[model samples]
Target: MLVAAAVCPCPPLLVPEVAAGAAPELDAARTACSDALSVLAAARPDRLVVIGPAEKAGRGTYPAGTPGSFRGFGADLSVRLGRADGDVVAERELPPSLAVGAWLLERVGWSHAPVEGLGVGESLAPERCVEAGREIGVRPGRIALLVMGDASACRTLKAPGYLDERAAPFDAAAGRALGAADIAALEALDAELARELKAAGRAPWQVLAGAAGNAGLSGTLLYEDAPYGVGYVVAAWS
Candidate 1:
């Protein structure tokens, strides 16, 4: 299976600006991701599979891209899904971590799954760009799943704390605005997703560890983001 993989960041695809330094933190991330994708592609899989939030779904449960369809990101990446020509679709479901995040949102507390709610964008989007690479053959153990999701900070439910002020100025307040309820929701999602993706039965599919990315924009909604977070994080089933 081409086995190509991409980092699963939360938004804007990481500002290129935050990734610079002597050690170059983001550089290392980019390097690892680039290397993994290259390696996977070389081995060859029918196509690469990435787990991203699709516009078609909401933050309720683990949702996968509609089978036999592709979600293309403009001027960015286009994700190709399903082997409709044959019959091989992802045998698994959305991981447990993702489920947790959604649950928390509906609850009264924060999920803490490291959510990066797009202050500007409508919502997290579906897989794209990475899948545009040329198709290769399928190869097990040849796969490498790099990950990077939303930034730790976000505009999810803006709130510093219960006792703190309800609102603040600029995007900085986004972090503060997040309440315990929001944190709980994010945690639930991450936890559930991490667990589901780590299934031992799915070998060769390394679930790279990761942390949240992208602090989101200056507003308090999840839509129309330009480009902010995007990087590979740690994984599961490694």
Candidate 2:
């Protein structure tokens, strides 16, 4: 069962080197992510799974040592899911979102548990996502998750998806659900609407809801903002 979970936005901008001169803009979000990770460590979980959105080519499981790079983003930096025991080569590379998750894990020098990665597609069926999460939750051992994805990419005219009237309310509801750890609300989120709003977190958040079923977790919203018009939220559940 899930002992603790952290929900964070997956923008490469979270990495200072990737953000370059704009790094200070996300300092608060970075601090909140660190705080969230501390809760997971305190839980003393036996395993840690990092889940995030991925494209068709990136979907699937990734081992602990799976490499991730930010070279495409103009930052000649690389990260791995978690340190593997000597010479454990990964089968495939991590997706962008998982790369961000790996970066966060490395930032905190994580060593409390064995780590792995799962890449969920943005267009995945809600039921399937939930089922996948259920499988993770039922596995033996104390499990922790670091979920990464953005709420919406259309909060303002400058946003990636451009300004959309529905963006704010959708993000507001998502933030509320995450902050309250309302599994039902998360599971009930309109997938079609989420697609229209370009909320990349929809599927991953739903997966979290499934993993947390009746786990009696309480949540705290550590951060919420729309820098660069993309919704970034950070929350911790324990």
Candidate 3:
């Protein structure tokens, strides 16, 4: 059953090295992420699963030792999902979003439970995502999740998707749902609209909704902002 969850934006810019001189701009986000992770740690779950958006090459399960690199972003940095024990071997590198999740885990020196990752495709249907999440939810023992994905990428004219009149409202609704752990609201998000707005978090957040459907978790919004024209929100559910 789901015991706790931390929701965060998955932009590669969250990494200080990638951000470089502009890193200071996300200090607050970093701090909020830290606090959110603390809530997960406090839950003392038996397993930790990190979920994030991925492309075709990165979709599927990633083992604890899955390697993730920031080299594509001009950073010679790499991170592992967690410590791989025994003979388990990670077959593929984590996608960019999961790579950021791994970085956040490392930043907190996560050692309380075994870790694993799932990279959900942006084009995946909402029902499929929810079914996948339900599978994770049925696993034995206490489980925690670190969900990563961005809201709208079109908050401003300079945003990745360019400014869209619907972007702000979409992001606002998403932020509110996540902050309140409103499973119905999350599950009801419009997939087509989300795709149009470039809100990558839609699918992942819905997965979260599925996993925590009966966990009775309460949520708190730690932070919300649109830096670099992308909506980034930090929330903790416990």
Candidate 4:
């Protein structure tokens, strides 16, 4: 079952190299993410799954030691999902979203649990996401999740999707739901509306809601902000 979870926004700007001189803008969010991961480590789960958005649905699993790079984002930096050993095996590169998750894992020196990654498509249906979440919940031994995705990208005039009048209310409701561990509300988030607002977190958050099941996890909103015009949220559930 889901023992714990950390929700983090997946912007490449979270990386110091990518942010460069503006790196300090996300310092608080980074700290919150670190604290959330500590809670997961403290839970001492048998398995930790990192979930994030990708270009396609049900993409293949990313095993431990998988590599991700930010060179595409103009940063000559790379990271591995787990510690490297001589037993290196070839693997596909992680999507940008999962790459950020990998960065977070590396930042925390995550060695407390075996790690794996699941990449879900942004357009995936809520039911499918929930089914996948249920299957993950039933896996043997305790499980923790590091969910990565961003909220509305249309929060401000300079936002990626350009100022959408509905973005603020949408993000506010989402933040409230995540902070309250209101699974029902999360599950009920309208996919169509989310798409319009360019909220990439919809599918992954629904999966989280499904994974939590009826387990009654309590939640805390660690951080919430709109930096670079995109809504970023850091939250923890236990």
lDDT of each: 0.25, 0.93, 0.93, 0.90
Tens digit of per-residue lDDT, candidate 3, span 79-185 = 99988886566667889999999999999999999999999989888888888888888899999999999999999999999999999999999999999999999
Residue 214, model 3, lDDT: 89
Q: Estimate the overall C-alpha local distance difference test score of candidate 4.
A: 0.90
Residue 207 in candidate 1 has what lDDT? Answer: 19
Question: What does candidate 1 score on TM?
Answer: 0.29
lDDT of 1 by residue, 33-99 (tens): 3443444344343323343333332222222332211112122212212213444344333332222
lDDT of 2: 0.93
Model 1 residue 162 CA deviation (Å) reads: 12
TM-score of each: 0.29, 0.98, 0.98, 0.97
TM-score of candidate 4 on Cα atoms, chains taken together: 0.97
Model 3 global lDDT (CA atoms, 0 to 1): 0.93
Best of the two (3, 4) by lDDT: 3
lDDT of 2 by residue, 48-136 (tens): 99999998632499888899999989999999999787776766788899999999999999999999999999998888889988989
Report the number of backbone clashes for model 3. 0
Model 3 Cα shift for residue 197 (angstroms): 0.9
- Worst 10-residue lDDT window for candidate 4 reads 82-91
lDDT string for model 4 (177-202, tens) is 99888999999999999999999999
